[model samples]
Target chain A: AQKVTQAQTEISVVEKEDVTLDCVYETRDTTYYLFWYKQPPSGELVFLIRRNSFDEQNEISGRYSWNFQKSTSSFNFTITASQVVDSAVYFCALSEGTYSSASKIIFGSGTRLSIRP
Target chain B: NAGVTQTPKFRILKIGQSMTLQCTQDMNHNYMYWYRQDPGMGLKLIYYSVGAGITDKGEVPNGYNVSRSTTEDFPLRLELAAPSQTSVYFCASRYTGTDNEQFFGPGTRLTVL
Candidate 1:
């Protein structure tokens, strides 16, 4: 069985604050994929990043960053100086297998982040 | 490119009615999927197609059906509309590669009464 847990249901922070959203996953497969997606008020999902099992490197894109630790089975996302435009719901997902035999993505319940200015 | 597109952005259906949610992608992706998201919840996979003419059930496929006769389109069919089936349906497509991320459609919001 594969599961992705995002315990934070909601988080509110003032503008320019740094916030981190935690994601923990459970999967027996040695090779799997992790993902982060953002859903703004537009009601459409926007893909943020995808990390494979072999890569444990932390990634930074502008004010957003992701820390992937395979040992703890955790992929945490952080936003530096979060602005009002950053208010949205974030989701963490997991999938098993390589390119050919990859399974469907299993998404966590999601965490809604509110950045108030 | 159009990426992935879904029809009828919003729809209201009465109980027992049948409808098909259309999805089309121009990316020439080999894998396509259908997922439903309830209010304030994550997406639950309903069905997926690996290639043309090959379809499989996902985590939740009881109230839905899907077909993949072509690589560019995968449509989900709802046989009998029920209140429990009311949700926002999303269609996604991805190329057969390790680094490729699934491209999602705008999604269809359905309400069953």
Candidate 2:
């Protein structure tokens, strides 16, 4: 079974400050997909990013970025110069493969981020 | 186009009552899923269907049932409502591909007393 763990339950940071949310996963499969999703106060799930096992390359999307490290089985997300709009609950998820019997994605407990002024 | 739509955004049910949560997707997705979100917790999959007439149980499928009679509609049924069953439910769909992303609906908030 694949399991995702987001150690930080909640985080607070001042506006325009940088913050990083940690995510660690456990999966026996050699290949799998990792994803990050954001749910704001409006209660809508928004897809942030998706990373596969083979591709450990870091990604930067405007003010958001992700670092995937296979050695530690970690996929961390960082927000640079975060604004008040960035306050939301972030979730880390894992899906094994397309052919896996249970292709259903499993998610972590989530990290609630609060951006203060 | 409405990627995914769930009806009855908010509902209240009494104990022993039953109701169905309607979900529909216009994106022609082959995989559809139902998930529930509890307080301070991540979403847990309740059920999923690969295609029409093919439904399977997910992590937490107790006290709930689902049916996929068409490619566009998947409805979730709660046989007997319980207080513990109160939570927000979300419907999502994904196309047939390895790198596919699941598009989610706004979600239905159900309260049982």
- The per-model DockQ list reads 0.72, 0.59
- Candidate 1 RMSD to the correct structure: 0.8
| Model 1 agreement with the true structure over B51-75: per-residue lDDT tens digits | 9999999989998889999999999
- Residue B66 CA displacement from its true place in model 1, Å: 1.0
Displacement of the residue B67 alpha carbon in candidate 1, Å:
1.0
Fnat, model by model in order, equals 0.68, 0.50
Q: What clash pairs does model 1 have?
A: none
Ten residues in sequence with the least summed lDDT for candidate 1 chain B:
B94-103
> Largest TM-score belongs to which candidate?
1
Candidate 1: regions farther than 4 A off: B98-100
Across B7-111, the per-residue lDDT of candidate 2 in tens digits comes to 999999999999999999998888999999998999999999999999999999999999999999999999989999999999999887647578899999999
> Poorest 10 consecutive residues of model 1 chain A by lDDT?
A95-104
Note each model's CA RMSD in angstroms.
0.8, 1.1
